[model samples]
Target: MFTSRERSLGKLVVERFRKRRAERINNLMVKEGAYWYDNFITRTSLLEGLSLLIPGLKFGEDVNDFRDLGNSNYRALLRALDKLDDHELQFFKTFINSHFYVCHATNNPAIATKKDMVLFSRRKLIEQDIKFNTYNTAYVDIAGLANDDNVFFSLEIGARPQKTIPGAGGSRFGNTYYKVAYTDPSFDFSSLYLFDQALMDIPQCKISDISEEAKAILNSRKYTRKSICFYGRKSLPALALSIISATRLLPERDRLVLLGCRTEKEKKRTAALSF
Candidate 1:
């Protein structure tokens, strides 16, 4: 397994710093306004400070969509950030980007309330630690087997979600969509993860050390810290992966890439494509 911390931070290249600024900016998305009313901003001037100190960081031109976020919260976020000095801004940036929030739903998949999202994220992280460490360090969401309409009916009300216990073939099918985010406060998994930390980031893992054989067997080379698809939005690519990617995941394209790189670590299909 590899992480951002293992990656080289040599010379503090401007490009890497740019990427960190991008990641920090993204984190602020969830910290503004009504979302803030619920999630709240624990780190006030963190982002503004990071933007000012980082040579490459600068706010982009006013965006049409970001405009929808209401100028007030954006301004509030910016104003709070304006209060910090350079060095303090650097510290705030570093500290704010280090934390990870899990995105999850409770027994309810229709809506992931903020409190429920928080709870689910925390518990899921601990659970993921166990599951990911198990299975030879492999984790799979085998939702394929659980994808029958009849199964849903049965599981929830018919016979699919039947057994209140673990066995299947019961009399009901239950709503089973779940999601969460997990993090390693220390970039112990990969050097790349660590570099992101230095840059004030929530770095994504690029690849793990699985054998080529394992890659060939699974027909996929990735696992994740979070996913693009949650609840009824499997069709929605992980928008947080990129501002553009989120726009794409809108109910528009069918050729969407699954946005489940788990924050940033990607599973590459190392083998060549064949007809």
Candidate 2:
């Protein structure tokens, strides 16, 4: 387990890294006569919340330009100017100043398509997670019925703080305990997904950037006599490729779903990076 200090430091490191990434995007935008929105949360979502605080602002627009949408951009920019306790307003400023730009683009999609893509992507990911969880639950239930063994599950990942021996100094009471070692219990069944929210929160510097300890736990998992699946429906090509490759040494029955795409019809024209 990581100490509170360690967790705080980790969060700080991630925030700094993301801020640097944001700055890089901002530089690119400035060079190209565009601006970068650096908010982790999307602008439209923030606008939806702000609509409750402020009035007479229309959320629906053909062009989706905040500045042209009856002074929404100006109002948000003004609020951020206060630099008061409004973090949302600060983020709103970032979003507005960026010209609502994300990455470099010559021809952005229509507002409807953009909104549809966002909504569809979120819904598909959630549906995939639900299916994976259902499979995991069913596998455990069958195993328990056969062997009468208890199974436990947790959606959380990462280390938690534990108190160690009392500290020798003032102000501090005890040493922060760290989980130096990890072990994968003889889980009747095990599974992993590359695009899980917890793993997605990690920066992509390297696999190690996430956690060496968590990786060790994953690497230690045995697939023999158990069902261990890996999902990658939402991973980028390079990431999906790497994750799929890692599954080669696992048990043969362990399922691995890499990137896939289909353009069936107008409603479900799916396109994604694949390996």
Candidate 3:
């Protein structure tokens, strides 16, 4: 049997695979401006959390822009990385290597479909991780099951939660109603922002020294929905767009997901290029 430390590494390996693959898909979707990208997470059963403390952070052009979302998220990533302290980072390396880091079958000589692999197996690994951590600083509650049936998960995507940007009020007027209520092993869905503030953009960029056309283009943009109900009947393309877009940036190899381009042709043309 694997040691406790070894098992944590194993989970990271599995989570990382999906993340890497998702990044590839995100880049393609971004380039294509595909309508389906945002809806994936917004409409599906996927779960995500928001940091309540985010509203208090100061905001300005220096941080909240479309292109800068990645930069903002990078800051969040640094915070999460800092949270690791020295002990966590040292152990994280081993966890990355102890598993099937790569899905050889997807890249094999025969036919392929990554989305198929995700539905068939990849997603099962991520299982409720989206909702695992209800608070900014806390541990996730893993629903332990057998390895093949393993549903345990956590976020290692490395993006920090954006706490500086204002809501720019995603066009709605209401007091926030989401809360964990309580923390435990079982997961619960409630009111929350879909992703981090870094991923969500408040509509204020084009209003600056840009043309009316540019303002229209900026206004056209929207953030992903904060909550998704798989049991429901709505299709949230916008939410999925943000989630998938965010997913597309995961580290490579074991972190690949099924969302990326299924063909080599697609992969080569739209693969994400880190800046």
* Total backbone collisions for each predicted model: 45, 3, 27
The deviation in Å at residue 201 for candidate 3 is: 14
Better of 1 and 2 by lDDT: 2
Q: What would the per-residue lDDT of candidate 3 be over residues 66-99, giving only the tens digit for each residue?
A: 2223434434444434444232333333322221
State model 2's lDDT.
0.27
lDDT (0 to 1) per candidate:
0.25, 0.27, 0.28
TM-score of each: 0.18, 0.17, 0.20
Report the CA-based lDDT of candidate 3 relative to the real structure.
Answer: 0.28
Alpha carbon deviation, residue 83, candidate 1 (Å): 4.6
lDDT of each residue in 1-275, candidate 2, tens digit only: 99999999997787667445434432332222111121222134333333323333322212222112213322433343344223333322332222111111112221364453211121233554622223222322222112112122221212432223435321131132222111222111222223321112222222222244434434454321111112111112222233333433333333121111111221011111111
What C-alpha root-mean-square deviation, in Å, does candidate 2 show against the real structure?
A: 27.6
